[model samples]
Target: MLGIKEIEAIIPHRHPFLLIDCVEELEPGVRAVGYKCVTFHEDFFRGHFPQEPVMPGVLIIEALAQVGAVSILSVEENKGKVAYFGGINSAKFRRKVVPGDRLRLECEIIKQKGPVGIGRATATVDGKVAVTAELTFMIG
Candidate 1:
């Protein structure tokens, strides 16, 4: 299990930009679980929609990717390597996420060869899936 402080050691995100709040689990090259709290004060909310603010779908995927990055970086073999968003496939937004919602982000490693890795990720709010995606990253 990894907390916010431990997670920060692996990723550089911080403040309103740091989408991940905690890592509940880390299975090295296998899987990871991360958490994030969405709030109304987020800068993007103002532009995404002022009246009926809905969390942007891209940011949700970004949060999931951050979780995947944490999982990759925490592995001792991958230390000092950076994970870059290589591509996204099959990404979909299922439900609306708003302020005060706690997002549970999970990622599982599908395959990895050399610097390229692929994973499946999902974000859930209140036990209901909010977003899902197939993400690829270059971790080297």
Candidate 2:
């Protein structure tokens, strides 16, 4: 498992923006599984909806992307490089993610050609899927 510090060493995300909490599984340039412990303390909860805060779908997608980043960036040749979103396709949000939920994120590189690739990603809460997407990334 890789903690926040170890994740930081591989990617460029910082506090607040760094959505993933820890990586439970990883295969450099192949796939990764990570988690995000959502809480009421999240800054976005303040303005997203005061009465009933919900983790934004975009942020959920970003969290999944971060997991994909870790998978690709962990490759020796890709070390220190940043993975930028080339595109997000077929994203579907099935359930609302709220505070206290432990978000499980998984991403597998489905295809790659040079620095560009596609990943199959998903985010789940408990045992149910919260979101799923096909992400395209460019290593820079």
Candidate 3:
């Protein structure tokens, strides 16, 4: 398991923008499983819907991408590198994520060619899928 500080070492995101809280499982370049503990204090919730406070779908995808980044960027050759979004495909949102939800993010590298790769990513809350996407990333 990786704490916030360890995750910060692997990725350049910081508070407010760093969507993932910690990584629970990692396989270097192969896969990663992470979590995000949503709370009413999240900045996005202030404007996303002051009344309902649903977590934005895009942020959920970003969190999943961060988990994917942790997996790919942990490899020795890729350490200190950054992963940029090359594309997002087949994305689907099945449920609304809100405050108090513990989001589980999973990503597996499905294809790779040099510094570019595709990951199959998913975000779930309480074992129910909230979003899934095929993310293309370019390492730099």
Candidate 4:
């Protein structure tokens, strides 16, 4: 399990911007499980839908990326390297995520070659997948 202190060391995100609440499991560059709590006060909820707020799909992907970041950087060789989103493919949003939902993101590293990494991730809300994607990143 990774606490906030450990997470803060790997990613540059902060409160309101930090999507991952805690990393429940981590296997270096292999796999990770992270959590996020959706609240009505989320910044994007204000303008996303004034009357009927739905968490943005992009943010769901971002949450996945955050978990992927921690997993990738956990490798001792890549410590302190910057991880940037290189591309996204086959992304699907299956359900709407709103306030009061607790999101769990599961990410598995598909490949890590040199400074380039690829992963598959899924974000679940209430035990159902809300988003899934093939994410690529450049680490340097």
Instruction: Return the TM-score for candidate 3, rounded to 2 decimals.
Output: 0.99
Candidate with top lDDT is: 2
Clashes of 2: 0
Provide TM-scores for the models.
0.94, 0.99, 0.99, 0.96
lDDT of 2 by residue, 83-132 (tens): 99999999999999999999999999999999999999999999999999
The TM-score ranking, best first, is: 2, 3, 4, 1
- Compared with the true structure, what per-residue lDDT tens digits does model 3 show for residues 1-140? 99999999999999889999999999999999999999999999889999899999999999999999999999999999999999999999999999999999999999999999999999999899999999999999
lDDT of 2: 0.98
Give the residue spans of candidate 4 off by over 4 A.
none
lDDT of each: 0.89, 0.98, 0.97, 0.92
TM value for model 2: 0.99
What is candidate 1's lDDT per residue for 1-140, written digit by digit as tens? 67777877887777677788889888877789989888888899998899999989999999999899988887898876778999999998999999999999999989998889999999999999999999999975
Give the clashing residue pairs of candidate 2, or none.
none
Local accuracy of candidate 4 as per-residue lDDT tens digits, 1-140 = 78788899998888877898899999999999999989999999999998999999999999999999999988998898878999999999999999999999999999888999899999998799899999999997
In model 3, the clashing pairs are none
